[model samples]
Target: MVKDQLTQIYTQNELSCMATYSIKAVYHKLMGEQSAVTWDKIVWNRLSIPKHRFILWLAMQSKLQTTAKLAQYGISQSDMCLICADAKEDHKHLFFACSYSKECLKQFKEWTSITSASTDLQQLIRNIQNGRRSKFQKQILLVGLAALVYLVWNSRNSSYWQQSIPSVNYVVKHLKAHTKARIWAVLPKKLSTKDYQWFNEL
Candidate 1:
């Protein structure tokens, strides 16, 4: 290695990849390539709010405490979901497979006119990757995914401690109103009237 460098080589060293390359860039590149399914865009998206992003972070880490996890940790013996009070609560079921969660996600999709092509969380996040969609469409879908996960978790905890759960319609209403407010804040004047109409209908 020393033989290949200049006379001053003994005085200094440098990253060998490229002059402009960075460790952060390499880390992100490696992360993007290592996954069996595409996940970088799913959680790294900027359209979602900070709190929602935090929820996705926990979810990807498998850190959210589903009843099944609690049981495995000896924290609780019951594995049933507090929301549905039927199926055992595991990460997969709590996020997507549970009937109650499915209902919430379904309403969110219907209200947003997204009609997600996949039912499960991972597949749904991947389905939104179609590059043909408008940029705003993609952004909104990503934000919607984050919002649904956060909403389901929030409602579950609320039901657990409050002894009551919000109706699916109520949750959907709140989601729409929140999305509408966010839309106005983000919509740029460069977007055409038609684009504005599309968001309004969403």
Candidate 2:
């Protein structure tokens, strides 16, 4: 119906329809789309997953990478991590397991006053969503998490393409810049204490 027609249009030009159909699909639910929370935008942009496929993939992967399965993509099964050459390339390593990422999370926890379990991606998202915080706080956390994921993935690509290593601070800095631009453009006001602190340090 309207959703299908809008989806077709969205596929053709995301920016042109940003104000009309996309925003409406998000905040207004003109079609059979889900309600837009900050998490919705965070997840959509960060993962690059289609809206319809996100939940299904979450159910399957729980946010952790199954090395055995993903190995078909040319990444070694034993190569558990692409960032920290020392760690296994799994969800924890990518997000919380690596030294740099661990440090970043430490700052994040201190700033946000939120704690996350050493779980897979799906669990982490759930933890952030169920957090006892304001909608604004929740959106910030989602943005951070999304930024972290996207940064790690890009770092992996860098490692492979350039045959070089990336520092923890480097990835953190990149994520901060990217997230800052996107969040500032779409949302009102400056970042919170935690996000601002991280951005400043970056």
Candidate 3:
């Protein structure tokens, strides 16, 4: 099938003469194009840690292997949440719906002054993307949210493997310190003075 497609392309392009062999043109012709997703910016933000971005990518697609997913495959014995133990351990419950994750998000919001009232992960990301904050502030919020998601998932894994979860305080503290340090390390050269001051104040 691939050979037939290549033969068609060659014949259509009339490669009998001196034809320029552009790999990019051939690749694009073969692969075609795909529409961009709304969360692309949130997941691929330059300010976010690479590992955090990877986890957020999986999470935005609901691809994380939570207990509920494991249970679907007869891998886990129960679908109960490992962190909260009061709900099914799916992507939604493990994000901000769980008590442990809720406190972490609340503290993060209080620290960052994020006013969005949404608890759903995707909705919160959309709020940040469309909020009336400065570009730098939006980037910070998105990166911080990604870090929170990564840490929350990490805490859930800790509970599953070690039978203990990190405290909410611990998670929030780690989130603040790690995210702040990460942004500080990669501060953009074009950052406005006001945004720099605001970041320093945070």
Q: How does each model score on TM-score?
A: 0.76, 0.55, 0.83
Sorted by lDDT (best first), the order is: 3, 1, 2
Clashes of 2: 5
Task: Give the top-scoring candidate (TM-score).
Answer: 3
* lDDT for 139 (candidate 2): 67
Candidate 2 residues lying further than 4 Å off, grouped into runs, are 1-42, 45-80, 117-119, 188-202
Per-model C-alpha lDDT, please? 0.74, 0.58, 0.90
- What 10-residue stretch in candidate 2 is worst by lDDT? 47-56
lDDT of 2 by residue, 57-100 (tens): 34234454435236756666566566566865655556566776
Q: Which residue pairs collide in model 1, if any?
A: none
Runs with alpha carbons beyond 4 Å of true place in candidate 1:
1-37
Report the lDDT of model 2 for residue 20. Answer: 55
Summed backbone clashes in each candidate are 0, 5, 0
The candidate, 1 or 2, that scores higher on lDDT is: 1
For model 1, residues 9-67, the per-residue Cα lDDT tens digits are 32235345356745575565445655464676668676677788888778867789888
Tens digits of lDDT, candidate 3, 10-118: 6755555527667787787667896668888779998999999999999999999999999999999999999888999999888789888988999999999989877
What is residue 31's positional error in candidate 2, in angstroms? 25
